[model samples]
Target: MDSSSLLKEYPLNPVVWDEMCVQNEVRAPYHKVYEFLKQISTEDLTRKEEMARRLFMNQGITFTVYSSGEGIEKIFPFDVIPRIITAAEWDFIERGIKQRLKALNLFLKDIYHNQFILKDGVVPIEMIYSCPHFLREMHQLNVPHDIYVHIAGIDIIRDADGEFYVLEDNLRTPSGVSYMLENREITKRIFPDLLPQNNVRTVMQYPQLLYKNNPNGLLGVAGLMSAYRKGNVAIVNAPGNGVADDKAVYIHVPAMIKYYLNEEPILKNVPTYQLNNPDEQAYVFENMARMVIKKTNESGGYGMLIGSAATEKEMEDFKVAITANPREFIAQPIISLSSAPCYLNGKLQPRRIDLRPFALCGPDGIEIVPGGLTRVALREGSLVVNSSQGGGSKDTWILSK
Candidate 1:
């Protein structure tokens, strides 16, 4: 039997299926992807996967999971489809991300030092006060570079019109950048033709850029604000950042902005209510069915309660827990997350997903990576995009044209 007959016999193996036949004649993007995959053999693809696994292991690129006991490191799941981004599209995304990061950094500084934005009524004081993430301990404290956000992964999603909008900001210890670099390497081996044909820009240099020229470099925030007499150089990613990234600490961001920057914030935060605030807590206690509650500092897909998905007993338990310690939780209205085409089983299906584009701050200016990690909720119709919760990732290729 030839390759076609072999494929008919073994339809479950993706490697065999892809190599056995010519894909349907599609348009530009899909045609391009299929053509590239056809050039590599099934055995070659397996070899590439092994190489990727070795590369990750040699580089010590692993994340710690707590439940498996402390110091249990695991490799992140790698996907073969390398998302491509064009130069022209990258230009727009880069500018937007930089502008947003700059404004947010300035906002954090101002909220901690002066109440200008709050006083001016651009953002309500109650919103800041009611945030579960607001860190009172950071008030009037000097961050070495006057920069609270050292690394940022701003989440964005494209709507039906194909326009992108900011969904949320991952300021503290944003993960998945490692996966971005590794994905590029894996794709290059599996589909070498995809790069030259698509004119994809190289993103391998990003990690090095992040390590060097940290915002806390010698020349500090003096240029942005003149209130501080001395500049201190400290890497914000010092030990204990895990504790700081908690959702409860988020409430203090606005206050951190006022107390440290002595200016007003330009960007707006999502409307939130702390379960601890007396009035807000009471309101949440009364209307548990209308809100999406989240634990202050949990990462991945854990510790979340979608009002529509909770049982009566669970809702009652949550109310009791909030009454005991409201500071540990926050609530927001559900925003419909975006979706994209994904290859599931054997067909293309719509999967709910989100994007996380990275931003860097330096004396010259801010740099935002044009391409982001497009994460999909692997389970059918699921909205959670975290890799820890049976989710998969795709490459985001920004169109050059």
Candidate 2:
């Protein structure tokens, strides 16, 4: 089938923005990809996808899912269609992440030392003391360069209007970067000259950038924890970062940007409501169906409830849990995440996706290699994109000027 036929088969959600198509016309960044697809038959695309999958299988690129005290290894899903971002979009994302990190690093330094943000009544002192991740031993302990967040994988999502919002910051051992690099390599094999033809920027520099800063490079090595205790190796992301990346602390990040960096945040945070507040809790309880309730310390799509998708039992269970320990929960409005086209079952389909771009901070500066891991909700009409929750991934392309 022609690209027009493929485009016609792919349905767009009127309420959700599409990355590749706007009113059935392919967007500028996807022009080259669209043209390439125009000449390929549907069978050809399926073959390419199959080839990509086999390569992943052969290469043993997989993630483990734990269940019943056992680990199940599964191949990480790879979609043929790449999620393309323009040069302008990438620049905005890079700048925003850098700005946020600067503030976060400063916040960590301040919190562990003077606790100025808390003392000045900026962030509630109770919030810090109550946080499970806050270590009392870290108080007044000086780290190298006083930098806590060295490497970051900040999760960013686009809303219905195509506006970017940071969903969360992962300052501690952020995962999925290997998949990002491998996706690009796999694309190079499947798409051949398409990447260069589209002027896509390379993500291969990620490893080099990482090693450049970590001369010791002892992460993931056996006895690394013992070495860390002896101060024999430096942790890229220092301890006590949980005090900064805590979901409860996320609400105060904009204030941190203004307080520490002396500038407004370039990217907006998704409007979040702390369930501990009486007013916010009342509002969320009243509009439970339109909110997503999550535990402050949870990750991997666990300990969360999607209100719209939750059953009566799930909602009631969450209500009881939140009421028991109000500080452990927060809620946000259900954002209609932007969708992108995916190749599945020999046809183009729309799926919700989110991006997690890795940013490396060294003594010199912060550098974000172009492109990231584009996680997709493979299920129809789902919003959650965690791999443990049956989500897949797409190659992200950041085009050059």
| lDDT (Cα atoms) of all candidates against the true structure | 0.60, 0.90
Give all TM-scores, in the order shown: 0.69, 0.97
lDDT of 1 at 341: 45
Off by over 4 Å in 1: 1-31, 34-60, 68-71, 84-92, 121-146, 159-163, 215-232, 237-291, 323-327, 341-350
Kindly list the per-residue Cα lDDT of model 2 for residues 18-70, writing each as its tens digit. Answer: 99989988898888888888888988888899999999999999998874458
User: Candidate 2, which segments miss by more than 4 Å at Cα?
Assistant: 217-232
lDDT of 1 by residue, 1-401 (tens): 13343224332322111211223223354456655444555566556656766866787766666654576667765444444444654675676666656656766666676857778776667656655556565566566655667678877654443455554567767888877776676667655667778766666768767766473343334543333223335554322233334565445445444554554433334457877678988777677777778877666767778777789999888888777767678887654455544544433344666778877776556666656687877776576777766677766665555
Give Cα distance to truth, residue 401, candidate 1, Å. 4.4
Clash pairs (backbone) in predicted model 2: none
Best by TM-score: 2
